[model samples]
Target: MKKPRNKFFQKNKFDQAMTGYLFLLPALVALLVFLIGPIFYAFYISFFRFSFLEPQNAKFIGFSNYIHLFQDKEFLRALWNTSLYTIVVVPIQTAIALFLALIVNNIRGKTFFRVAYYLPTVTSTVAVSVMFTFIFQPDGILNKFLENFGIHGPNYFNSPTFALPAIMMMAIWSSVGQFMIIYLAGLQDIPEEVYEAAELDGARGFRLLWHVTLPLLKRTTFLNVVMSMIGTFQVFDQAYVISGGNGGPLNSTLTVVLDIFRKGFKTMQMGYASAMAFVLFAIILIFTLIQNYFLGREDK
Candidate 1:
């Protein structure tokens, strides 16, 4: 009788598993239909030559899209601009966030400062971009302040040399608050006992940070670096709004995503744009993997 009851329980467990899978079927189908299906279809479309204006007339061109991408000077320039932006903004933003986190962690009014810093993160990107645009304008506050010191400020968005850097500066300002919040959370997770013990051993200030704080904040640093890099690489709003959607001056602010938008929508080269999208995706994936690998090795 006991053996029979166990057999019945095993059958019931199998039935419950089947029911759970059945319940998940619709969600799985939705994911495949909407996300996975579109990605694979885009991959297929990238190898061909198609125009959104005449999608029905698409022709198989055998990697001609990618070949054109390689030879396209404008695309190459966008790639270079994006690389420079990521290299500069990612490190600065991460460092600033980490520093802010450290300072806030030791303060008594943690809640007040955290909320104040995080206010920008919850603000609308478009509003912040427009605000920064005005602030960086030739006759705006920043320039006026510089003029008070007997210095002239260049037209930030109007000059080719300064356009990309202007966008980078705005990007850093807009995103740093959120990353600071993340780092703060990481810092709070460090056990109080570790610091207390370190203090007993004569560790203080910069030495405490270098030996104790940063060592334990490895995971947080990795997360912030990867997230910031990805965000900077896909930057669009600041460049688009500041440059008036032309990616100017002289296309100096044209990022990879901006190039993709121009090709996909303005030029109506959907297929070629898909290839650019895939390239950008691959670049992001490679960097993320590199970050994870190093972080994991450190853990081991």
Candidate 2:
């Protein structure tokens, strides 16, 4: 019975799959020409000591770019900053989002809260960064509020100690809504019967949440973690705008992507920048794989 069914699908599906792929050809070509082509070109360029200004005189330098990348102090610092940002921001954002989702899921006027929370996620990042910059300024509303409590506010963007932390706070606030929506969708999809069973078993309050809701939401949590992790790792726009195009405040807000932009555009070291980008890609890939191992694994 199974062999006959398999033979029938094999006979019918091959032509259908080919036709589907034919329909996808335009998108595939666009992907290749615009995205994949540039990626491979950049990888090829990474082996040469190429510069935007002196492209005609580019020299083949083999693995020197990658070698020097590991030894470069500023690159190391940027790597560290990027890693720290991911570590601090992803978990906080995920937690805040999950909390907000739990609250909003059960509350009256949830529609209002949902719109309010999701507004920031839809807002432009540059605008958000600029707004936060003002908010974090010494004479801004945040500082003025602090002043009422007799607390002197620091120039957050200009202080190495507070610069990265300030960005982290903004990132958490701006991105949490998106993750919360994901959690909300996950919550909505959960079968009502599961809660009924848990209640019948006397699982109430935190116990019900711990034993029922959380276990069911593991996949949602994993999705949030992976996406947020990737976003945090690639953080550049806020750091660039906040730091005035240079990772200033004593290089405290320097991120990997921002540093790559500096090298590629400002310094015209396209080869070195390409190398840094590939390194960043590797870092992201490794972290994602680790997350998959822990969070995305199927239960026995």
Candidate 3:
């Protein structure tokens, strides 16, 4: 009789386990096919000499692809360009976003302000790039505006010196609003009593903001910085659109992702491209971990 009871309980436990797995089946299947599959496939290809153009010609080359990547001048230039973009853009954008959020938070018609500011963020990157391409031309609106002030503006996309900066300027302008919204949300979460208490302690204006607001908004700043850093590193669409897929005028605006696209698709060097991608992944991971260590520690 005791053995029969034990068997009944075991059978019921197996049925429950099956039901749980059944409920999770669709999500698990999707993950395995989409996310997990591509990662493993890319990793597999990165160790070989592979080209999608001639799939039958694949040969295992161990770490040669990665080795060659470091020796490639274009890849090295792209890595430097991307690092520069990330380093310059992240802090500037974060600061601008915080400034905009603070201004909007104090203003009337906050909805209108938010909508106006966030318009560029929601606009398609391709469309923005195209528009800016025209605007940065020799005789375009920007140059015309500069002429009015007795200053001359160079043809932005055509010059190596100004090309990257033009992209950086446009990138900062378009992205600030999105991060502003994030900062605005974080600003709202601060208890009013905190401000009132600070006011009683003679904190006002910049003093209040510096001593109270910024310190409290550290987590929001952390999120914005991380997101902005990642986005800046992976920037491709605008660079592609602006440079017309050549990564020129002298590869000034060539980002890591754009270089990867050029290698994989245009040049048909899929294995090399995969290795470059993993290097980018490693760089981003390192930066993110460093940020987390410092910023997260400050939060604690």
Candidate 4:
């Protein structure tokens, strides 16, 4: 005899699938309109001399904006600053995060320590920048502390030599907690049996970490490196807030995103800004690809 068809079950399944799509509709529509739409619009406007102040007079400039970007010394400086920031901050932050994760993983009262470590990550970037601004001032707490040791601290925001380093320190401090959480999660995933086996083979303490833990956490390290690189390259809020939006101190803290904001909003060079945005996007893509290649190669 032929099996009886469950038409009711089929209908219910169809209805549930429809409901799922209906539920997702709002978020999908919002993403397309707000995020995807702006990306394409930026690309379209990059080829034109679009002026936000005079949108009616926008004219096609072909690749002129892109060509001029190469010759724009300020833009070049911003790119270099951003690249240098990424190069310096990523490794330092990754190492700090990994070290914190390792320390927390082996400690008791883990929850308390985790919460305490993550406070900075949860705090607002603007608030932290404002607080640091006061702290880094010439006569601020940092300088006062230095003076106790008979060393004078320069005004961090006003000194070209110290401005970028000050920002780098802030970025690392704020970011390490978040990445530590990620590393902690990765550490838990490592099978205890693996460690036990390594111990049986005479691995202990630093040897275990240097061999098994680090090797197994390669994927997590790659993730953290890529994330930190992207964040460092696009750093703007702290730089903008600390520099008061001008990227002062001889443009030491000027980043590509801040430069784009200046060009797009301050100068109303919308097309040029859009072009720079794409260039930044390209640079990020290239760096990410290179990192993936190197990391993936090492994994093999």
Instruction: Find the candidate with the highest lDDT and give its number.
Output: 2
Clashes of each: 0, 0, 0, 0
Please list all clashing residue pairs in model 2, or write none if there are none: none
- RMSD to the true structure for each prediction, in A, is 1.8, 3.8, 2.7, 1.7
Ranking by TM-score: 4, 1, 3, 2
Compose the digit string of candidate 1's lDDT tens values, residues 16-88.
9999999999999999999999999999999878886787898999888888888999999999999999999
Off by over 4 Å in 1: none
Location of the lowest summed lDDT over 10 successive residues in candidate 1:
237-246
- Return the TM-score for candidate 3, rounded to 2 decimals: 0.92
Tell me the lDDT of model 2 at 221: 95
Which ten-residue region of model 2 has the weakest summed lDDT?
291-300
**Tens-digit lDDT track of model 2 for 180-241:** 99999999999999999999999999999999999999999989999999999999989999
lDDT minimum window of 10 residues, candidate 4 = 1-10
How well does candidate 4 score on lDDT at residue 13? 93
Q: What's model 4's overall lDDT?
A: 0.93
**Using lDDT as the measure, what is the rank order of every candidate, best first?**
2, 3, 4, 1
Taking all chains together, each candidate's TM-score versus the true structure is 0.94, 0.92, 0.92, 0.95
